[model samples]
Target: MAMKMSLKLNSLQSIWYCVFVVVTHAYLIISAFYHYHRVRQMDWPDGTLPKPELGLYMLCVTAALLITVLFIPTQIFQVGNNANDRTKLGVEKGDQGPPKWKGGLKAKLVFVRRYTKHLGPVGATMHIVSAFCLLLPVMFLQAREIEHGLLPPQSIWRSEVSLVPVIEMDRAPSPPPLIDTDLMSTNQPDLKPHVKEPPYKVSMVTINYINYVTALVVYAILYGDVFWFCHKGFALLLSVQLMFNAIQYSLGFIGVSLLYKLHTYGWDKYGIPEPAVVSSAAGLVGLFLTNNITIFLSAVVMFLYGYTRMKESELRKRKNNVEDGKCSVVYKGNALRCQGYIPHMGALCVLVIFIICKSPLIVEYLRAFRHQGDPRLLACMLYDIFYIFFWAFLWVVFALKREWNFNFAYLDEVQSVKEESSQSAGSTGSLVNDNGMKNNIELSFVNRYNQDIHQRHNTDKVTEVKMSPKLHVANNMPVITQASEKYSPKRLRNGSATAEECQLLHQKQEHEPIQNGVLNTSMNGRPV
Candidate 1:
């Protein structure tokens, strides 16, 4: 029997998804142009992977674009266009689509399978090459940065890793994806039933163990703060610090994984291995630059973040019962505040620097290989390349995405406010409070409406800023004054209070809500 498939998304959700696809596509288009232009500009022999590995990187990126595009069904909401709506598949009204079914993990798995079928071997090989190309420099020039004691370059050292022999001190195969021989998979249903699992699985499958080891390693290698502990008596400061580090590392790992998966599983017809590496080189560059660049980015983000809260605090100054459209302080005078996405731009700028400067670790690794006289050997000797542009592009994409999200969030709020205002405008007399003064005339009727909203969002933003008791805020720290406790604590801007305000607002240490005086940390998705 011939089967028909249909997919549908909720109205708003459909728009968001479409926006995501469009933005992603736009990034790809820009990157592609950059790659093509740079390629032509360089006038290198056609099709050779760019040194520092840009060619393969671009190819891999192109493949990723294809993979992402495939999953986005153009017919976002298909109900047979009304005529086909009355299909024989038994789909009901308002059912969201054919068979009126939800595409949960099962659908995702199907998409993944289809994706793999199209991109399996080619993309996989490209990824292998990408990893291979990236490690050479680490093995060569960058080896000094890592500590791998008394072993063969740290690749062959058998600990959690098994394959690539560490040429240095037990350093888990120089670059990584070290195999845990015990856990290697024997299944390769996509390739062959009996074929041993790809070496990548050694890294992918055992990553959890790697994380566990990382934690233990931190415990062994890192020292808890002593001076602060001596003075402030912070009981779990070390634990908190460890948790934050873990979270940061995990996020970085996730970003790399996303890039990796996009290159490997999420590629299109993965062909000649060399070009694929060139494509991913860009992503690698972005990841590398983040170490330095993100410090700047994060700093700016934190500041703008705080500033946004300041704007909110300013807006929320005095005036109880902020009616739909009324003059007060911040929004009272001006409906919207354009702080701009300074942090996102900073992140992009730094990532651009990474892209501009990225080079394959090959030069360094090649030196080591040459010095060690194993020029022909790379235990998993599948050479990959790295580049600056493609890598930086990943960060650029993220930065743009951040902007897009911010834009959408603001738009959503605006639309909702307009709806509410239009409704309220009809019911109540001119929202201009009795001074016969059009208090809200300064704002576009819509802006005023949007700024003033329902829902007790105020309380959600009234979160306490936590600092280890060991860290002290001097009396000179910034201060925030509270007006009244009557209003629900909506997040004013980024919802951060000044240092002094946060200190004053700190939950009393004596009134511990949770065990260990965890205070009212809402990060765990629960109130203490």
Candidate 2:
């Protein structure tokens, strides 16, 4: 049956555009967490706990300053005063709005509570961003038609427009297996050659504009009296993308070592069957060789090598921990789930196999729907759909992380549960007595349960110890805990401090572990 579908911008492709976003926005997310964990471990002039919420605030503030004020056009063209108006109602005392936003307008003005604890609305904001990204392109197109007198621009206010992609996807059957098919001519008719689809940059531009708008909207929400998330989530994403690009570009130029390259090539070329690397071409690739055994072989070698390297790195880290009794350095986690990671990689792998095997299924789909059935024949298009979903999913994850980075309403008083009962053998004193002075050194190190990075422990729980020497009175005595496992900082609340203190504390958090601290910091950085 013949079928026709119009191609449009801003549908599935919008998903693709958001992929790179995974790299940048995730950075800020990790940064928020870093600050959270950092603040938890630190100690200030008073015997108060550090609030991760400050890092969250810094991030939200940054997002607001950069995106809302800078990237977006100042004049908001959208209709209405804003659908998310919750502050008009007179807020009474005792009711912590949404259990996250900790203060009223007056308290917020005076740097009332430790970081803005209202994290609930951020999820809604993320949903809005995703929906906006999907729908804006369609609106822009309608806007275009209005400009050309084909459609009215005011139609947006009405129900005349919808945000669905125009492309029609016809699911096609899988191609006959290469081994099962006959090499010689059979009863089946020869198929027509396939051509590249026409470019859709117009829609792309529209998508770009919408993305800019959505980003700006998110930026503006960072400091709202109620709930907002942007800061570290956005920052981490940017940083991750930058680092990945740098590494990829570097790898592209140097072309992995010569011996390494030769060893992989040798096995792939002639079933030498030696321990080899993974196909160097396995990850994100540049040039590809399809319908050929050579590239496929290369992939196997590259895979082996990659696997070996990963194993070696893990072993090295293990050895260090065993000998030095010091924990290994842990890199930040990626914002997106790994499901996207392997699937995207799979698409590339499948691409290589198709090149070598020249799967007949691809040929039939092209013949059946080159005009209307191309979606069926094109595995790449399917890959395109998956990639889009991956990006959007990552955006949601990044938004959640952004919230985690900032919400500090609960930091007022964080009590440690240890009570000097469960201290390890190598544990130091809970209370240090000095000459004539009473030192009430409390082991505020709270109990931490987390997964073990090493393969030694199969279970996903570990205890954490907090030893802040900064609050120690005696110069000779120091707060120390056995370095058996990595320390997970315990956060108390989000707070504020002087800019000088912030920078110094921020630096210390990055390098040395936190000692002690507290301040009621606002999302809009202040001395509280």
Cα shift from native, residue 217, model 2 (Å): 9.8
Error of 2 at 167 (Å): 23
Model 1, 1-528: lDDT tens digits are: 234565764245434544654464455446555745654454334453234434544554565456445434421453232211111111221121112134876666555543232111221122222222222222221111111222233232222233342222232323434564666655332432343434342323233334233432232112222112121222133334333333433333333332232243323422212323325634554544454344323323333432233333333422211323432222333222345455456646654543343233333233334433332323212221222333344345544542211112322343343334333222111111212221222211122223432111111222333311111111111112222332123222222122333333433322444533222333122234
TM-score of each: 0.25, 0.20
What lDDT does candidate 2 reach at residue 246? 28
Over 4 Å off, model 1: 1-160, 164-209, 212-341, 352-362, 369-387, 395-528
Q: Which window of ten consecutive residues has the lowest lDDT sum in model 1?
A: 470-479
List, residue by residue over 34-122, the lDDT tens digit for candidate 2.
64455445433353332333443454535533442221221222111111222211121122221333566654433422222222122
Task: Tell me, by TM-score, which candidate is best.
Answer: 1
Per-model C-alpha lDDT, please?
0.32, 0.29
RMSD of 2: 29.0
**Candidate 1, number of clashes:** 48
Candidate with the greatest lDDT versus the true structure: 1
